[model samples]
Target: MISTWRRRVAARRAAKKKSIEEDDNANMELTIPNHFRCPISLDLMKDPVTLSTGITYDRESIEKWIEAGNVTCPITKKILRSIEPIPNHAIRQIIQDWCVENRSYGVERIPTPRVPISSHEVKEVLTKIEDAIRRNDDESCLDFVSMIKSLSKESDRNKRCVVSNGAGRVLSAAFDALSKRDPIHEHVALHEEILSMLMISLSSPLDEETRTNLSTSESLHYIVRFLRFGSLSSRRNAVLALKVILSCNDQEVVEDLVKREGLLDALMKLIEEPICPTTTKASLLAMYYILKSSQSNPDKQATISKFLEMGLVQNLLEILVDSERSVCEKALGVLDGICSHREGRNKVSENVLTVPLMVKKMLRVSDLATELSVSILWKLGKDEENGEGTVAIEALQVGAFQKLLLLLQVGCSGTTKEKVTDLLKILNVHRQSVECIDSLDFKNLKRPF
Candidate 1:
C-alpha cells in the first residue's frame, strides 16, 4: 500500500510538469480572430477567462475585460467584446427597420418624451404674485421669488423659459394694471421694498422686448439706484443687471449714467474700500464703462487719480500679491491698462501712478505668488519714461535688480524664462542691469543674459 501511494504522488508530479510544458507551447501558438468577441459584454476579450456553465463573472469585471479586447475564453477561442450598442454589420438593417416603422407621408408623429405643465398651474402662480403686488406685500413677493427659484432648481432650461416668458409678461401687465388702478402708488420713487423685487426680476434673463419695456417704466429708477448702492445681498444682482443694460451699448444710456448724480462718486468710493474685493473689482469694471462714455477731461482724470492717490496702487497690488491665479491675472490686466492708457500713462509719468513704489511692493512680495507676476513685471518694464523701459532701468534702486532676478526664478516655465533672459539682456545692454545677473547661478541657462 505504501509503494502504491508513492507511485501515485510521482504520477501526479509528472502530470503537472507535462501540463506546464503544454501551457508554454500554447502561449506561443494562440492567435485571436478579428471578428470574435466576448458573449457577456459583447466586446473583444482581453486575458479572457473561460467559464464553466456554473461559473459566472460579475458585470463590472466583464466590462473591464471588454475594454481590453485581447481576453479570450480558455475553452473556445472567441472575441466577443464591443462598445457599439449594436454590431456594425447589422446597424444598417436596424436603422432601415426603424425608419420604415416611423415612415408615413405627411404624418405628424408624437415626440418620444413629453413634459407636462397645466395652464392653470402657471396662472395660479401669476395671480398670487399679482395679488401680492396689488397689496404692496413684501412677504408675498419673497414667496413668489422663492417659488420661481425652487422650480429653477428642478429643470433649469424649462423653468428659465417658463419664468422668463410667463413671469416677465405677467409682471409687465401687472405694472400696467397697477398704474391704471392707482397712479399715485404706481410709478413710485425708489424704495427698498420695490427695489428688491425689481432686482430679482431683472436678474432673470429677460427677453429683449421685456427688457426694453421694463427699462421704459419709471420704476427702473429703483433698479438704477440699487445698482449705485444697495445692501450686499442686492448689490450683485443690481450690478449684473446694469452690465446687461450696458451691453446693449446704448450711447444714450451711457450718457445718462455718466450724468447721474452719484454713479461716479459711489464707484470711486467703493474702489477705496479695503473689504469686498469682488465688489471693488466689479466697481472697477463699472468705472471703465463710465470712463469710456464720459469725456476724457480733467474732471474724469482727477476722479480716477484721486483713487490712485488714495493709494489704490497699494491696495490693488496687495490683491495681486495673494489672489487666486485667475483673479491675480485679471487684476494685473486692469493695472496694466490703468497705467498704460493715454490718460493713465500720463498719470504714471507724473508719479501719481508711482512706478518705483509699485516695483518696491512687487519686490516685497515673493516670486512664488503666481506665474502672472512675471507678466506684471514685464508690463511695468514697458513704461520707458525717462529711460524706464517698463520700470526706470536707469534709476532702478540698489536692491531692485536682485528682486527681479529672484522673481524670474519662481513659477516661470521655459518660454517665460527665455523672455526673462531677454529682458535681462536688454537691461544690461543699457548698462543699468549689469550687476544684477553677476550675483546669480546660471550654469544651466541656455541663453546668455
Candidate 2:
C-alpha cells in the first residue's frame, strides 16, 4: 500500500512540476534610465514632445492625458493655454546617441518619430491614386503605391485616414490588375508594394463600401491566388484581407470561393504549418467565417465536406491543443461551426480527444475561449445519438461534467449560462450509466432556462 501511495504521490508531484514549467517563462528585467522615461508611463519615451506648460512627455501619453479632459499639466498642475505638442528633438537625439553608444549592452535605438498625416493630404493622395488606377497607368500606380505605403508608415492616424478615405479599394484594384498580368511584364517589386498597401489598409477598421469592393469576385480570385503562389508578404496580407472580407457579409463571393478548387486546402495547410502567428490567426478566422456561412446555404454541404476532406478537424484540434488563447478561441469557433452539421457532429462525437481537449480548454484559457468551447460541447451534446447514450454522456464520462459545473459555479456570460444549463440536462439524462457523475451534484446545477 505504501509503495502504491508513494508512486501516486511521485507521479502527481512530477505532473504538477511539469505544468508549472510549461506555464512559467524565463524572467526578463529591463531598465530605462530615469531621464529617458516618460513621466506618464515611467517607460522610455519614443516620441517626446513639449507641452505648453513647459514639460516634456511622450506624445501618445500626453495626448491621451489631455484628451481625458485634464486641464492642467500632470507635472506642474498648471493650466495650459494650448495643447499642441511641440516635438522635443533635443531629447530624442540624446536618447538615440546614448542608445548607439550602449549598443553592445543590449540597448536598441528608438525609431524615427512619426508625424500624423492630415485628412486633407490623404484626400489629395487618394484622388491621384484613383485616377492612376482608373487609367491603368502602371508607372503611376507604382509611384502612388510607394507614396501611400510611406504615409501609412508615418502613423496609425494616417493609416486610418488611408482606409476611411477608400485606400483599401484603390490598393486592391491595383493589386488585381497587376496580379492578372504576365509575370515577365510586371515590375515584381511594384506588384508587391500594392499587395502590401492593401494589407495595411485592411489592417485598420474598414467601412462597408471598402469591404464590398474587395469582396468582388475578381478581387477575391487574386487574393486567393496570392495564398497559393505569392510571396510570404503576399500570403500573410492575403490571409488578413480574406479574413476581413469574409466578415463583410458577401455570401455570393464566399460561395464562389467555396466552389473554387484548392482554396480551402491552401488555407488549412497554412494553419497546419503557419508562416507566423498572425498568418495562422487570420487563416483560422477565414475558415471560421466560411464554415459559418455554409450553415444557412443548405446547398453548401460540399463546403463543409471539403473542409473535412482537407483534414480541417484534425488541424483545428491540433491548434486547440498547443496554441495560445487567441488561436484556441478561433479553432473552437471553427469547431463550433463544424458541429452545426450532421457529418461534423459525427466527426466531433467519434473523436476521443475532441471532448477532453475542449473540456480542458473551457476554464483553462480566457473567458472567451471558455464560451466558445462550452458552446462546441453544447452543440455536440444536444445532438441525438444512440450508443453509450448521448454525446453529453460521453462528455460527462470524459470529466466535462466537472468543468461545466465549475463554469456555472463561477460566473460566465448569460449565453454560456443557457448553454451550460441545457448541457446539464443532456448529461443528467444519462448520468445513471456514466460512473463518474453524481446524481445529487447533477440536480444542484442551476438550470434557470
Candidate 3:
C-alpha cells in the first residue's frame, strides 16, 4: 500500500513537470518583449535607431516619418533638434541575441544596417568638387565625383540626400567647365565620370530651380556630345540625363533639343546597335517625348520627316517582331505617332511584316499593346477598302479578320471596339477572297456586317 501511494505521488510530480514544460513552450510562442518593438511600427525593430528625442524606432519607419515632413517625435511629442537617427547598438545586439535564441520558433536575425549618408556630408563633397573644378584639378575632380557616385549608389536614402543637396547644379557646372577646356579629348575620363554622377544624382525628380539649371542649352550641348562620342556606359548615361532634362516639358527646350544635329541619329544608333534593354527603352522614350512635343510646334512635319529619313519605320517594325511586351508597346506607340502622318503611313505600309505582326500582337500582349496594335492597323486599313490596298490584302492573308472578330468577342475599350469594327468592315470586303474567314464562326460576333 505504501509503494502504491509513493507511485501515485511520483506520477503527480511527473504530470506537474510536463505542465510546466508546456507552459514554457506556449510562452515562447506567444510573447515578444515590448522593449524590442518599435513605438511607430509596433513590430520588433530590425534596425533600432534612437532619435534626438531619446525615443527608439526602426530605421525605415522613422526615416519615412521624417521624410513625410514631420519634425516632431511620435512618442515624445517634442520637436526634433536633428533629423539624423543614431543607431541603438545595444538594443540591436539584444534583439540579435533574442532572435538567435528563438530561431527555432521561426525568428531570423536582422542584418547590420549600413549607415546612411547625411545631407551635410553630401554638401561637403559638393564643396570639394566645386573647389576641384575651380582649380581645374582633373584628378581631384574625378576622385570626388567617383566618391559621390559611390555614395549615391549606396542606398535610396543616400541618393535622395545627394539630389536634395543641390548636387545636380554643382555637377552640371563641373561638366560645363570641363567640356570647355582646351584639348577636350584629354578630359574624356572626367567627362564620363561627371556624366555618370549626374545620371545617378538626377535619378529622382528635381525641384524647379534644379530642373531649370539643367535645362540650359550649354548643359544639353555637352550631353549630346557625349551621346555621339562617349563610350557605351557614358553614352547610356548621357541619353538618360537627356531624358530627365527633357522631362521638364519646356517647349523651347524640346524644340532646341530636337534641332540639335545628330541627336536623332544618335538615338537611332542606340536603337539599332542596342547597347542594353534599358538604354534602348530610354532612347525610345526620349524619341517619344520629342515626337509628342512636336505635335504643337510648326516644325512637327519637319521632325517626322527626319525620323522617317532615318529609317525609323523599318527599325520599329523589326522591334515589333519579337521584342518584350513593354518594349513592343513603346515601339508601337512611337509607330502609331509616326503613322498619323501620311508619309509615316506609306513607310509602315511598305513593310511586309507590318500587318501580320500587328495582328499577332493584338490579343497576345497587354491591353495597352492591343489598343496600340489596333490603332496602327486602323490607320493603315481605314483608308483602304475591298482589300484593294496592300495593308488590307496582307491583313486578310494573315487571318487578321478572324483576329479582329475574336478581339471584339473578348471585349475591349470603346475606342478599340470602334477601331475593330472599322477594321472588320474593311477586311470583310475581302473576306470572300480569303478562304480562312469562311471557317470562322461569326455567329458570336456582336458587330453587324
TM-score to native of every candidate shown = 0.48, 0.72, 0.80
Supply every candidate's count of residue pairs whose N, Cα or C atoms clash at under 3 angstroms.
28, 0, 0
What is the per-residue lDDT of model 1 for residues 1-449, given as tens digits with 9 covering 90 to 100?
Answer: 99999999999999999999877765564332333344565543322332332223323345355446645532254444532121232322333344445443222322222232334555677778777867876477557645654554455433544454466665654443344444444333313433334444554456675566455534345445665666764565555555556556556666556556665555555655533666665665555555454334444565456546555556556565456544454455455546534555554445433444344444333333233444444544555523645354522443345545665754367765764565555555455443333223333334324
User: How close to the true structure is residue 359 of candidate 1, measured as C-alpha lDDT?
Assistant: 46
Q: Candidate 2's C-alpha lDDT?
A: 0.78
* Whole-model lDDT per candidate: 0.49, 0.78, 0.85
Candidate with the greatest TM-score versus the true structure: 3
| Cα lDDT tens digits for candidate 2, 246-272 | 876578878878777678888987987
- Give residue 43's lDDT in candidate 2 (0 to 100): 83
Give the lowest summed-lDDT range of ten residues in model 1: 105-114
After aligning candidate 3 to the native by TM-score, how far in Å is the CA of 348 from where it should be?
0.5
lDDT of 3 by residue, 1-449 (tens): 99999999999999999999877886775478999999988999998999998999999899999999999999988999999899899999999999999886778888888888887899999999999989989999899999989988998988988988989889887887776678877988998898888887775466766676567777677789889987899899988988887777778888888889999999999999999998988898888888778766655798899999999999999988888987988898899888787778888888888887887787777789989999999999975654466787788887788788788787899999999999888877777766343333334334534
Indicate the residue-level lDDT of 57 in model 1: 36
Lowest-sum lDDT 10-residue window in model 2:
437-446
What's the C-alpha lDDT at position 100 in model 2? 90
Worst 10 residues of 3 by lDDT: 435-444
Backbone clashes counted, model 2: 0
Off by over 4 Å in 2: 1-58, 65-124, 154-166, 176-189, 203-205, 385-387, 437-449
Error of 2 at 235 (Å): 1.1
